[model samples]
Target: MNTRSPWTVVICAAAVVTLAMGVRQSFGLFLPQMGPALDIGRSDFGLALAIQNLMLGLAQPFVGAIADKHGAGRVTLAGALLYVAGLVGAAYATDAMGIHLTLGFMVGLAMTGVTFTVMLGAVGRVVPPERRTMAFGIVTAGGSVGQFLVVPGAQLLLGQLGYHMAFIALAGLIGLAAVLAIGVAGKPRALDADGPAQSVGEALREASGVRSFWLLNAGFFVCGFHIAFIATHFPAYLADKQIPPAIGATALALVGLFNIFGSYAFGLSGDRYPKHYLLAGLYAARGLVFVLFLALPLTNVTALAFAAAMGFLWLGTVPLTNGLVSQIFGVRHLSMLGGIVFLSHQVGSFFGAWAAGYMFDLMGSYDAAWIASIALAAMAALVHLPIRDAPLVRRPLAA
Candidate 1:
C-alpha cells in the first residue's frame, strides 16, 4: 500500500471521513423514533446534537493546529476512539443528559479529528497543485458516498433490528475506522518552505487581517446551519407530513447520491472558474430550492426529489471552500485556518440544530426553521463576494 498511487492516500483519507460521517449520519435516523421511545422531546434531541456541533466547532481549530504540527494519523486515531466511545455511550443512554454528553460532546470531539477540514488539508499536501480542486472534490465526494451508503442501511437496520442495536453496530464500524486510520501515518508538509512553524496565534492574526477569512468564516456558518437543520429535522418534518420514516431515509440517501456528483462538479468548477462567484451562486441556488420545497407539496416523491437537488448542492462547497483557503493562505497553515473557518460552520450548526428544535417546540412545526435557513443562505451568498482570494504578503510580526 505504501508503494501505491498517491490517490491511494486520497482514497483512504476520504474513506476514513466517509465511514466516520456515515456512522454519525445514522444518528438522525434514530431521532424520529428514538425521542418518543426515550420520552424525550425534540428540544432535548436537538440540544444534544447542538452540543455535538458546538464541541465539533470548538475542537476543530485545536485539532487543526495539531494536524498542522504533527500529522493527521494521531488525530484520526484519537477521534476514532472518541467516536466509538460516544456511540457506545449513546446506545445505552437512559437520560437526556447522557445523550448530550455522549452523543454530543464525545462524537463532536472525535469528528474534529476525522473530518475533511483536517484530512483533506493533509491530502492537499501530497497531491499536485494544479489538480487540487478536482482532488479535493474527489476526496470530498467519498464523504458523499458514505452518506448515501450508510443512511439507508441505518434506516433498514432500525426497521429490522432496533435503534439500540444500530448504535452498537455503528460503534463497531467506527472501531474499524481507527484501524484504517493507522495507515495514515506519514510525513506531513512543513508549515511553509521558509517558516519553522505557524503558531495558532500567528495564524489567527494573519487570517483575521484578511477579508476573505472572515467571509469564508461567515459563509461557512450558513453551510453548518443548512446541514444541521436538515439533517436533524427532516425526518420529523416528513413524518409530520405523513410520510413513512423509511421515506426520510430514502430522501437522505438521495441527498448523498446527488452530492457525490455535486461536490465533484463544484470542485472541478472551482478549479476552472473564480471560486467566490461559484460559492455565491451555490448559496443563492440553495435558498431558491428551499423556497420551492417549502412553498410547494411535502410528499415523499417531492421530498426525495428535493433531497437529490439539495444533495448536489451539498458538500460540494467543501472542496471549493477549502481550496480557496489553501489558495489564499498557502497550504502551510491550511489545516489550522480551515479549522477556524469550520468552527464558524459548527457554530451555525449549534444554532441550527438547537434552534430548529426550540422553534418547533415553540411553534409546533419546522416552518420557522426553513424560513430562517433561507435567510441565512442569502446572507452567506453575499458574504463571499468581497473576499480577496489572492495571496497576502506575510510580513514579520511585531516582536
Candidate 2:
C-alpha cells in the first residue's frame, strides 16, 4: 500500500486542479479582446473554443485510462507541458486556424490530464468511502478558488500586459502544477473489503451494462452545456447589454467566490442526504435563477446578484456526481468511468459554446440561447430522478 496520508493527497490534488481550472476559466476573459485582435467574428472564435471543448471531452476517456494504468502524476506532468505549449502557441497565433489548432485542440487535450476527471479520481482513491463526497468537494472548491483569484488577475494582466502576455503568464502558473503532481503519483490501492479486486476491463464492462450510468452521463451533459455557455458567453452577453467590462470581470469573480461554498456545502449534504435529489434541486434552482435574471431588468446590481446566485449553484454537481459514480461502481476504475461521464459534459460544452455564438450571429441577440439553457436545466432536474444509488452486486471470482 502507498501509505501517503489522505490529507497530503488531497492538498496536492487540490493544488493541481486549482491551477488547471483557474487558467481554463480565464479564457473567456480573452474572447472580447481576441476577436478584435484577430479580426475574426464571434462565431469563428466560438467555433475554435467549441473545438477546444470537443477535444477536451474526446481526450478524457483515453487520458483517464492511461492514468488508471500508468499513474496520474506522469499524465499530469505531460499535460502541463502540453498546456504551456498550447498557450505559448496561442499567444503568437495571428489567425483563426492557428488559434484553433493551439487553443482549441492542444489546450483541450492538455486539460484531459490536468482537470477534475484526473484530480478527483486521485482524491477519491486515497480517501475513505464515507468521507469521499466531502473530500471531492474540497478538491472541487479548489477549482472555484482558482476561478475567484485567477479571473481578476487575468483581467489585470490583460489591462497592463495585453492578451498575448497574459496567456504566457497563465501558462507559467500551469507549470507550477507539475510540481504539485508529485504527491498523487502511482496506482491507487483498492479499499473495498468484500469483493475480490477487479481489473479495469471488468470495471468498464460492468459500468457499461448499467442504465443508471447513462442517466448520470445525460445529467452531466446538461452541466457541461450550462457551464460552458455561461463561462464563454456571459461576459459578452453582459457587454451587449452595455455593461462595463469591469462588471463582467467582477461577475465572473463572484461566481467563482460563491462556488467555493456551494461545492463544499453540497458535498457535505451528499453524505447525509440523497445525492440524486440534491442534484435534482440544484438543476431546478438553476432554472429558477435564469428565469429571475431574465425577467428582471439588467443592472450592475442584478448582474452581480445573478452571478452570485448562479455561482452558488455552479460546480456543486461535480462532487455529488463523482461521488455517486464511485458509490455505485466502486473506485477501482473511478477515473475512467468518471471520464466517460465527463465526455458527455464536454460534448454539451462544445455545442454550448458553438451554439451561443452561432445563435447570436443569426438573431443578433442571445435571448434564444438563454431560453434553451433554461429548458435544458429543467430537463436535467428530471433526468436524475431515476438513478438507483446502490452499489453493483458483483459476485466473487472463481477460485
Q: What is the TM-score of each candidate against the true structure?
A: 0.96, 0.98
Candidate 1: pairs in clash? 263-316
Please give me the total number of clashing residue pairs in predicted model 1: 1
Against the correct fold, how does model 1 do in TM-score?
Answer: 0.96
lDDT of each: 0.85, 0.90
Off by over 4 Å in 1: 1-5, 191-197, 395-399
lDDT of 1: 0.85
What would the per-residue lDDT of candidate 1 be over residues 308-372, giving only the tens digit for each residue?
Answer: 99999989889999989888877877888888989999999999999999999999988889889
Q: Candidate 2 lDDT, tens digit per residue, 1-399?
A: 446788998898888888988888888889989999999888888888889899989889889878876778888999989999999999999999998999999999999988999888888877888899999999999999999999999999999999999999999999998888788887665552224577778778888899989999999999998998988899999999999999999998999999999999999999989999999999999999999999999999999999999999999999999999989987767788999999999999998999999999999999898999999999999999999999888787889
Model 2 C-alpha RMSD to native: 1.3
Model 2, which residues run further than 4 Å from truth?
A: 190-195
